[model samples]
Target chain A: MEKIVVVGLGLIGGSLALDLKKRGDFKVYGIDQNPTHVKKAIELGVIDAEISFSELSEADIVIIAVPVNIIPKLTQKVLDVVSNETLVFDVGSVKNEICKAVENHSKRKNFVAAHPLAGTEFSGPEAAILNLFDDKVNIICEADKTDWRILDKAISIFKKLNMRIKMMNPIEHDRHIAYVSHLSHVSSFMLGKTVLEIEKNEEAIFDMASTGFASTVRLAKSSANTWTPIFLENKDNIINSLNEYIKNLKEFKDLIENNNEEGLKESMNNTNYIKSILNGLK
Target chain B: MEKIVVVGLGLIGGSLALDLKKRGDFKVYGIDQNPTHVKKAIELGVIDAEISFSELSEADIVIIAVPVNIIPKLTQKVLDVVSNETLVFDVGSVKNEICKAVENHSKRKNFVAAHPLAGTEFSGPEAAILNLFDDKVNIICEADKTDWRILDKAISIFKKLNMRIKMMNPIEHDRHIAYVSHLSHVSSFMLGKTVLEIEKNEEAIFDMASTGFASTVRLAKSSANTWTPIFLENKDNIINSLNEYIKNLKEFKDLIENNNEEGLKESMNNTNYIKSILNGLK
Candidate 1:
């Protein structure tokens, strides 16, 4: 692609712009509602220039990396402006909403709904870094809805970024992601809230936070603006995941309450199976 | 300190042995119900030799680093066999039971109760490494019950390991640690369990586990042997923390269900305060 436009110059968008620009294969421009982010993206050399939505007409590729709540409308607007040959895709956490929003659009064939499963607790333009998408999984939902050429372009770009690709239906993608990714954020945030509520003395937390607590609560630091929409947009799956999580927590509580040492040991032993799964031993 | 006996040569005990041995100021010996750990500690140079409980009489310091359920009884046994000048201490996660168990002993003055707040997800003698306790906090409980000289010896040894000391009552320590340390473990394990249950394809978890999930679930990989007793021993505090944590999760769920965007944003915004707290931004 000769020209590319990255919307919402935040962690994913900014990082993509930086990497694409560094490769010298694409002329990268950024579009953000936040003027500060637009300015910072330029100052940080994340993009070659700032461009308006109208510039989508000249772009060979357009990437929407906005929050899930706004991704649908943004994707639609980009689709309206892009040329027939231009490939438009989103890096949203939730896929079903955006996929359905543009399913019937005239330029639907140009839009590919994608979710790149990679991020840190940090957010915003400055939080972006080089090669953030390297060796990560990029899930493309409803791939059949997009034209073959558009899908090929996205596959080529993501592969160039060293990402592995997987294809799934939008509904299935949302359900699985809600359990694995979104639920983790909820558990982490609540853990932080619970501990901070009880330990009013901040030094106690600072002194006692082992590597385990630090790692577990790291996601609690993620931006509220970024995650609120994700949890809200993917409400049904999130609620289901939350209900299951609460059930597990209650079962554990009951085991502890009854002093069922054997039962508690079994519960932990089963969960410790996570070690092998996480380590890819499974 | 001339000679030290480190009971239960697992992560904490083994790490302590390694640090002390590195100093070349003490001759550290090992004891564990697990012969594998005892043998490994010797092989890893974590201890100079493996010794029986009967050898406790020769040690100037007796460090009990066993699982919480075994700690109370083992601590009392160590106190019974140690010399009056010996500084005996238990590094169990929960401290109240161990403190109370030795409260009426004639040699109570020889015992110090401590919880060193440092560990990795891994376990056993093979998991031990040098300087694990460096700059970590060592919480000493019920110090007044112990002889001042014994307390001084305990403090000096931790200081030599480059650990800072904090003093608190066992009850307060248990309550606070249940929130900061214990709750994180439960949340992480449940997260791992929930994800593993929902995502039947283990490859999805391995492929999509970003830095956030990896860090958030890091504690789930910890040994069940160490954590099961901790959950049971500090059952009340853990239950209380879990209750609060579940309440927070439910509230978040409700907000998402109602599409109460403002509430979701506020809750996450409040929890985001952890960012500053964790980074010591304040």
Candidate 2:
């Protein structure tokens, strides 16, 4: 049986461990700096056992699923210890810094930079669920930089997890993801803040909140610990996206204030194009 | 069987007609300036028949489910033709103007001002679905202005559709809904526009967009015809909310630019309170 060690037993890590375990005859071990998460991941069957960094050499695979801010350093640390045969990958949202950090390392080809475009607003081991990545897109950045053999092994693993593979450079991945994923989280969180700041009557706000509001604000409930790092690591791309978002918002505000019904309707109609594109998504 | 006439055969009106038909032996009729909507409503069985405004006198209950811009005038028109015993209501998103429009009408007591807190992102008669209003909130504004008998009938009907009734004044309804409902639509539309404007690569965006993005921008798929009037009708409150929303977004952007990780996390943590409130929703 193959041995797999999953570091940082949060939603992405714990879920990966559980799904990988069910897919093959692997002894999945978990590790987390938070002791409670380690205990819970073991208790919840998210991992077969809890393992330490010292034991990483015995594993056939090392999965780094920590927050993005710590990922570059942690990837280096994991690569330093893992045997040449072990497949090492980090599943962080932002990929550029991590990819750049290991560019000149002796074990650079041993690491595969990958991000599975999957998650819920909830975090921690308890948030882990079966098939979380099933049929989802898994973007592997700088695939050419990884050794052919290591890349092949990573592809097979992702296949077993039922994910579709897409290859791109780290720079492209960060830019697109800033627009599609990170910006949505920021927009939702700020919307939540605006409503919370103004609506003093909590009961009234909750009662009046329709399905539309709930859906639009759903991402506002995501964990701060998980996202703060993402915002910082991908700050440039995210800042660019945020500037565009704010400019559009201000433009929309002007339309409403000026009673530009035609302009507002045209803007909304143009955006309705998203309906068709998103319909193709899960 | 009581005759229930639903005007504007869009999602809200059409769904109400279908749900009302299923709950009782009501002969539901629909009216729409859009002949396609009227025909579609009849074909979808959302309404039993099509009727003219002249036919409203025959109805025991008349529902004006048109756009907010036209709702006040159409509601007053409906009142002019309805019998003294007939119950009339408008389910537009904005309430203050509609309420004020009929405030001094001879038949003011016959109209119940309402906004059912339920709908899908989709619009038109085909978007109508059974149980759309089930377990949702029905906000009735200015119940005091409605005759006791008419208010009682509206309450009973909402109960039959499996909704909880909350009474509010027109001013309060518009103000609160600006935060919880209208503001959400604006933010989502602007977010969609921003992404569409910047990402130029539609295929790339659709591939990378996770469920979080899907949920946050779902309301962007809502109809321009349905929402244009809503934003215009309640411009003051909507504009106010947008200002606050834009301010928050700018502040969040600045936090990211300055690398203020702690401030960003604290903001997200505070907004997580929405999780509890939304959990109570369907």
Candidate 3:
């Protein structure tokens, strides 16, 4: 059986391992700096066993699912050890920096910069769920840079996971993701902070929080370890998105303050177009 | 059969009408200024028939489920026409205003100040669904002001609908809801508006928008007609919440700008308490 090695045995990594293992065609091994995660992943059957960095050359594929800040150096390190025939990829939210880091590497053609747009608020090995990437988007940034044979292998694996492939350059991926993904996390986290700060009575929040509040604030529960690095690595685009978000919020507040019913209705009506967009997503 | 007259044939009112009718004890009738909603409600079996405002006097129970801006006047009008023995209530998100509006009415004791913490981003009769209020919170404000017999009737009906009863004063209800409910809507709407403004490529948004973005921005799809009055009526408290929300967003932006990884993680970690809180909600 071909060996599939997954680094960073958290939700994404462990989940991918579980699904790939279910296919029953590959020996999936996990590596985590946290020994507890490696142990738990093994116990939970998220992976067949643990593997070391030195053993990477024997692996047919290596997947890096680490925090975005660590992805660049870790990708470089993985590429340095993996054989030229081995296909390697990193599943981090931000793409530009990692793509740029590997741009001039001699073995760059073996690396694929990918981001699977799938996850939940929970983290760690225990949070690993089956088919998390099924029918989800797998964005391959700088696809042109990867050798066609290697890229074909990566695409086939994503297809096996039932992911829709979309190709975009790294800069475009980061810019779009900043608005759709990173900004949502920031808005949700800040919302949770604002409510938690103001509502001294946790009981009130517990009793009064509707599904709407729960939905809007759901991302607030995401792992700080995973997101802090992403926000920093994608700081420029994220900052721009945040500026735009804050401006819109200030404008909304002004409309509410002035009781500009017409303006408020107009603004929200325009946004209601999202209903169609969201339905399309479904 | 007891006559249950629901004013405003939108999601909340229509759903309540449908559930009550499902029990086969009440002959539910709906009233809406929009002829389309009334027509739709009848066709969907959300209500047995349409009732005119003039016919409210014959109602054994009257539910005022109009927009928050209209609730005060509508509640007063409903009270004017309903019989002394009839129970009446207004289901508006803002409580203080409506409670205060009917405070001096001779029929004040007949009206229950209620904000059933239930609904969806969708509006109109078509959006109504069975069991929408199942296991949800039903916040009754100023219950002490409601007559014992009338309040008992209202409580019993809510129990039948499978809602958990929580009593809070109008001021507290408005304040808490501003944080937990109204503020979320504002944040979500602004998030949608921000993305729609910055990302001119709607196709990119459609492809890149993950479930996280969908959840966080879901409330942005809420009906403007339903929410405009709410934001305006509850402006003071919503404004307070918005200011705090914007403050947190700005602070978060500064942290990202400075690459304050520690600060960012700490902020998010603290906010992650929402996880336990949300888990409690479930």
**Candidate number of the best DockQ:** 3
| Residue A145 local lDDT, model 2 | 89
Worst-scoring 10-residue span by lDDT in model 2 chain B: B202-211
lDDT-wise, the better of 1 and 3 is 3
Comparing 1 with 2 on DockQ, the higher-scoring candidate is 2
Task: Tell me the spans in candidate 2 whose CA falls farther than 4 Å from its real position.
Answer: none
Could you tell me which 10 consecutive residues in candidate 3 chain B have the lowest summed lDDT? B202-211
User: What ranges in model 3 sit over 4 Å off?
Assistant: none
Write the residue-wise lDDT of candidate 2 on A96-167 in tens digits: 999999999889989999999999988999999999998889999998888999899899999999999999
- Per-residue lDDT tens digits for candidate 3, residues B61-139, read 9998898889998888889889999999888999899988999999999989888888888889999999889888899
The chain A TM-scores for the candidates, taken one by one, are: 0.97, 0.98, 0.98
lDDT for each candidate structure: 0.88, 0.91, 0.91
Q: Write the per-residue lDDT of candidate 1 for residues A85-194, one digit (tens) a residue.
A: 99998999998899889989999999888888888888899998988888888999988888998899999899888888999888988888888898889999999888
- Per-residue CA lDDT of model 3 for A1-282, tens digit only, reads 989999999999989999999864999999999999999999999999999999999999999999988999999998999999999999999999999899999999999999999999999999999989987999998888899999999998998899999998989999999999999999999999998998889877887777488888889999999999999999999999999998898999999888898999999999988877767665
Determine the C-alpha RMSD for candidate 2 after optimal superposition of all C-alphas.
1.0
Candidate 1's fnat?
0.81
Candidate 2: which pairs clash?
Answer: none
Error of 1 at B91 (Å): 0.8
